[model samples]
Target: MTGYTRASALGPITEFVETRGGSIERIFRRVDLPLALLDNPDLPLPLREQFKVLREAGREIGDPFFGAALGRVVSMKKLSAFGAWVSGAPTLAGAIDRSGRGLNRFLQTATVLRFQVSEAKARWSIEFLDPGKDGRFQNELLGVSYLIDGVRHYAGSGWTPTLIRSTCVGAEQAAALENVFQAPVLHDAPVSAVEFDTALLSATGPERKQPDFGAEPPIPPPVGLREEVAMLSTIALLEGSPRIDWVARKLDMSRRSLQRALDREGCSFSTVLEGLLKDRAVALLLAQKRSLTDIALHLGYSDSAHFSRAFRRWTGMPPSRYRS
Candidate 1:
């Protein structure tokens, strides 16, 4: 899957920038992102663009430790559903395992979370599959900080990683990171990981009061061309209308090749895009109390009237009727 991240994932950075008197609109424009996109935390953002925004925001503010600093302020409440579920796990080990299964639900592509338990230590690592990208270091920092924050929420604020390793940091940034993590920070490592005492895995943590709805159903691992395209379309739809060529480029294939692949699956790109939009439209109508105009604009409609026509076409009823 070409993974996507929720726009809310940048909440800490957004708060940091705004507090520093930085213009978030200018930052969004610099990254070719719509300013209104951040309004809905659950909205999916292309992982590539998410990284670009982070890197640009950091560069604009001249803060080398931007990611790490942001991580410190990020709370479980800001992490959305995934964070809540992790906090509810009975032990630190359980949280790590649950996070592994649900990582894709949070980030749709280009990132991975793995948990390994050894006799001496338990290692939880996050790897950004795309290393050549601009914000690799910042992402690494952010990921590690997030893990630490989650652990502290349940394990007590005193918990710390036994060792921290990153593939992206340099000597200058290492000291700042070490101070934040309060653990040895190794730079230019093979993978970005946090190691902790194995004993801590079995240590009980405070129980979190999960909502009655419980955790989100685990997403099945995406496989094959159709699923890959569907995942990409879901991510693209969050920003605006999904484009076949854009999805093709994200999949690293030419437009013709992408069309041929869809043909083999007995579906076309337009069908996939329509299906995704309809699903998102229905979801927003039922789940959120947002006005029709806001929902329409979110789905990339020029206005509510256009959205109403599309909704009627999809469900044989206008969006307002469907909501009622």
Candidate 2:
């Protein structure tokens, strides 16, 4: 499974396409995606569909640099919750670390951001654990853009990376990206990354006004089987396909023992796994951007027929009708 991404990630490209004499509806239709999903910027769209949309949009707009062009216009305000969490951090390094750790929460099962710190520089890179069939050019471009934009929010607009490296860009595309990033972009690098001075990590930005969600309270630690299972499930999903045996091994117990523990907690292993799958399925369907076949493969189903039957049992409706 490629997991999912917020719809706002596609905002800049959508706007760019629309402004350049392209129809948003036509683009979505061409990709077999629902146009209505665009209305909710915070909704989660399957990552695979995001790639398809960008690739199709590039073809539609007749520009090979469409992704890079779109990246130039993206701002942190467009990233929603992930942006908020990044913006609220106290320091540049803290923000980068927070974004890397919490990325899976906002993007569901995807965790492609990697951060490394040394005496001289801080390197942040994106290398998908599973690249899948589609190339990662657009995703890499958008990721670099988002990192630059988010860092600028804290490090000031004048901040630039020491260097930018991307695996997908060519000499021509790299030149265009250089104009946007205002720095040298190395084409055909080992990975897509931004290298920054380590000293800047401690630099502070203007104080952000905290939201009035509520008063702060003491935080409690996660305790019990449910929390453990949930945490393990998330790890399994992000790393690859989730399996009961793998989870049991992680827990250092036999599958029977794990099931008995969950049973004592008034839940079965299948029940918990099914619940997580159902939640993920609903999010994908509400986005209305992926076919049943794609969704099935994402959920680790061997085939769509089995996935359809399970989905029907879970929701009492077909996956297609559920989206409708």
Clash statistics: count for each candidate? 2, 0
TM-score of 1: 0.73
Instruction: State the lDDT of candidate 2 residue by residue for 1-324, as single tens digits.
Output: 335566666677788899888887888877655565666555545565677788878888887656667777877644655566666778887778777776676543454788888889888887655344353676667778778776777778888888899775479977877886789899999778988888888876564534221322212223567656665575455433577786776555799999899899999877888888888888988998988888888788888898889989999999888888
Instruction: Look at candidate 2 and give me any clashing residue pairs.
Output: none
Per-candidate TM vs. native?
Answer: 0.73, 0.63
- Give per-residue CA lDDT, model 1, range 145-180, as digits (tens): 888776676567877888888775588677777887
lDDT of 1: 0.75
How far residue 70's Cα lies from its native spot in candidate 1, in Å, is: 1.0
The TM-score measured for candidate 2 stands at 0.63
lDDT of 1 at 291: 94
* lDDT (Cα atoms) of all candidates against the true structure: 0.75, 0.71
